[model samples]
Target: MDKPDQIPPLSIDEISILFFNRQNPVYIDVYDQQTYRYFIYPIINRTVFFGCLIITLLRPLSHLERITIEQGSSTLALELAKQHTLTEVYYQKTHEYFTELLEYRESELILTKGKELGLNMNSIMFVTLFKISSYQDLQVLEAIIHRLVSIIKQQMARTEKIVYGFHNKVTLLISLSSSDSDHISSITKLLDSIIKEWNRKDGPPLNAGIGNSYYGVENIRKSYDEAGKALSYLTEQNRPGMIRYGEIGLNRFFLNQKSEEIERFLNEIFSPLWSHKAKKNELEKTLLVYTDSNRSAIQAAEKLHIHINTLYQRLKKIEEALNLSFNNTEDMLKIELACHLKRTFNA
Candidate 1:
């Protein structure tokens, strides 16, 4: 019941809301799908009430039955409201705690807040960012965030995870009991599954970028930064999938370079074929495969599923356009670098 995904199937139509004393304490009447009776409960507020209530009811209620229950529940309502106040306060505090942590406040202050929230800060942890498109409607986006947080919490029920949403992004702070590779692999696979499921839905595409794990609370900000960097790398590559900060390799250095600089380099190297929109992917793929194959025409041809003569012909066209020779060491290295940069930044 504590898991986020365990929300009861309470439909909007099945809910009857009553605001007692002008919204000071709200009473919710729910018809539980699993039980064949009705239950009326008082909640502190609407925003934090989901998954916080337990109801037992199945059938629709008669007008008289509803009134009788509402009138009789007044005494119980006050007691429940008092109990739920603490929960509302806890959520507000937790939200503030995460906001401060992500904002890179003073380390000592962060540690104090972590202790207050009962969060373990000494464990091995990393941050993973789920970058969603901003095209979704505001209400729909909020629902998506809530659903995603629930799914992630449910998936990592055995592990320690903190899921938070801000704007169009969802930040996942996962704490590991140990730095074992097996634990990392299992969690990574779970995140990959989540991304795949998200894309399978009918809305915007989803991508994940994971940062490396580190110990201590001070490195939480570092992990978050790495996650953002990895996400930028993934987006610029024009791909849909998860990318880990450690996996991006030399592209990490490229990311550190200003975007304008990267663009300048791409334009300089690819000036010859800038006008060839039709053969861009095909030609880029050809050059990359050729360079990656140790400049072996046979191997490159085999990989590209083309005849060696065809490979030679494409190389000739590339050389003519760039006015560079493959035999020149400097020119060949420049070509290799250009191909990689073009693929990485998609400039």
Candidate 2:
């Protein structure tokens, strides 16, 4: 057998058989410096051997060149397959760790894994969820997410951040240095930049929800839950903006209530307005404007683009419809509460 670097002489019949009968063979030219001759050889199954005795007896040089290029492409494809397999395995293992961290299970083991993965669990950490507006091709979305993650990781290297894509959303667990006081502001700026980049690239619109930052790996689950809750609110409200868990305040209390419960409360409070088919929304808006204007008839009318006397007339109708006098502070309080509920729940 000839070595890979050696090319032996052959007859035209042998070259014809090699080209037609061999499977996936590479053709190359070998130069003999001593004899100053160029030889054509076929590399088949890891063995090098000569082709046609006269180069012209073989197929056109163009055909041979095409085969050589195809061989190079095949080799490149094989290498890429190997790399993709390795990446899938790595992602599986990392996903397991992520699941455990989010569940708050085996804190010590997760912390150890974090250490092995070069994550700093001692820093102040928060969770953020970036939600895309609609479904897209998984591969395309993943490519976009990978690019965004690479950019964020590169920019936030000093902050110790980890990003993952799961359930059609990109989740980021970022840590801040001890001296970082404006954590929410910093993350908001980062998200704004990311969203701008995504928009520039014609990607789906993205909304981000951030959780409160806490110290230590054990508290990561709390942040994750908070982030998820914040994301749910953003989705339910159909609003595209960043919301922090801590900033929701009293709205969180109302959001936690069941839809049925909220509906029942609204029905009970606004039954009189509900009875009016043509003017329910109009009356509700009037009440809301009045309440927002601190019950000042002039200001409420001005805001609503109505006359002061018209505002008083509407207020009187509201009082008669609810069968309660606004002079009674308790009744006024109930109306104010109803207005708040309406504004918050979009009822």
Candidate 3:
């Protein structure tokens, strides 16, 4: 209040204080004798006598209040630190279980350990893999990951969960009651909110893939693998956001295959279509739309913005060139899978 208008703009700390002050209302202790005396007596007597008296009276109380706040803060900090330490240790152990990366014969031992660590072994447990990208600075990436982890912990504060990070990815193991109906929907909503919260802070691009919940220790690795596969589907197609493993369908199997293998599989099924120079791309589009539209010629034509007769002619050409009958269930199945594989590889 005594300073001139030549002050610099607010520093980070000053802005933070301003933010906190705006968020929290200011409180006035009107009943305090010191406040009453200081404001009223200073105006009336215009002397330092009451001011000195108030200070002398308030000194001990101020000291005691300061000590109380300090000790309370210190104790709270220690308790939180201890709790966080224990949580991290449990998370590390869970991470180790995943790190084993294989189902072993000593699954009972691992299950016992998990139960002891507060994991609900008999309940529905699954994993979600999170990946952060588009950050070139290591320090910024680390900070973003840390912020994301904090957000996860906050969001799942009421749940039994294990959160551990390695490199640029985080693995979250969440346990739900077996009777919790609509688990996938609930999980999706939770993850969507978490991602939105992170986005609100202008955090890095985040993507997650959720695995199906399974019982028993042997399926833990499978769930983790499924989560990774789901995430791979997102990355391979250059898409973002969350995908559940069950939703990926057959791509789950193909995702584990090598690129060359996928290419060969695609080529075997699509060679004839690719060999057609003029309409290869068009034919592929037709096949994909045909199957995706549930083999409804009218729907496919409407989507393709062409007449039904034209769609029929294109289908005929496709069948003739591929030396297969769309009427045959096996042939149609192959065509459908080929389309899926083509998309999975973005070919």
Candidate 4:
């Protein structure tokens, strides 16, 4: 296969000399971060018409480019980008360089392509449903999450909020953006498309958040949260690999926190109870609600719509069965985390 370095990277020094050597240029060549990073050779030509041949052959962009031309001067640079499906391009010298090109969006597209190429997610918007059955493997899993997070670096981007709520499995996601009317319908369609594509595939245990049309890298965590809930709903429902955020709806954020691995955590927590699937599931539900209701048994009962006494009885039974007391702040914190485990790791 051809290599990037083999293709040649345009040198800034060489390009500067070439541009300055030209006569009164109608369109002087300018290589922004994207052009410089992608092309070993700078994009330069005698007129707007010259360098487009190269750009059309290589589509390396995450956004559409815009080019403004003076009337009767030349054909537009943006026209070339659009015809070739280039991420973006600009003609006017006054136009700012493609700063957003190197934006997190580029990283995300690269990550997505990596997944398509069968590489593990460096985490980010794609929530990993890893099953580290033993305690030792959990270390590797933790390392994976940490590394994945650092690779994506969502914090530095201009995006919507990323909120995490874990029952045990970490539920990171980006918030939805309904600000643009054109985007709302597109987002829904995109989510639907993901559901279709997921149902089509049949391989490695898949769990993932279907991203939204929000033009923010930060809201990736919200998308991750929705996927996690859909995974949680999987435990209740028989189907697997079917994740649609609309199914989880408003309470989605509660299931979005970051936490420990869920499947193993649940298995360890309910070892005794797992023998009886119904009772184990009952405990899981109660804990889920208990935490979801913010540690208030009364509130949990109200949400579950069971009598407060019934909730108290279940809590008491859960405490006795698990050998942990929610009354103890530390124990309660652990339980809250465990409760999240039932949701995140696709248990």
Off by over 4 Å in 3: 1-94, 97-118, 133-137, 196-202, 216-218, 267-281
lDDT (tens digit, per residue) of candidate 2 on 23-66: 45444453444322333344322221212222221334577766
Q: How close is candidate 4 to the true structure, as a TM-score?
A: 0.31
Residue 236 in candidate 1 has what lDDT? Answer: 73
Clash pairs for candidate 1 = 37-57
Per-candidate local distance difference test? 0.69, 0.68, 0.66, 0.44
**Model 1: residues >4 Å from true position, as ranges?**
1-92, 99-118, 237-240, 256-264, 271-286, 304-317, 327-329
What residue pairs clash in candidate 3, if any at all? none
TM-score for predicted model 3 compared with the true structure: 0.64
lDDT of 4 at 74: 36
lDDT of 3: 0.66
lDDT of 1: 0.69
TM-score (all chains, Cα) for each model: 0.65, 0.68, 0.64, 0.31
Candidate 4 all-Cα RMSD? 20.4
In terms of lDDT, the poorest run of 10 residues in model 1 is 13-22
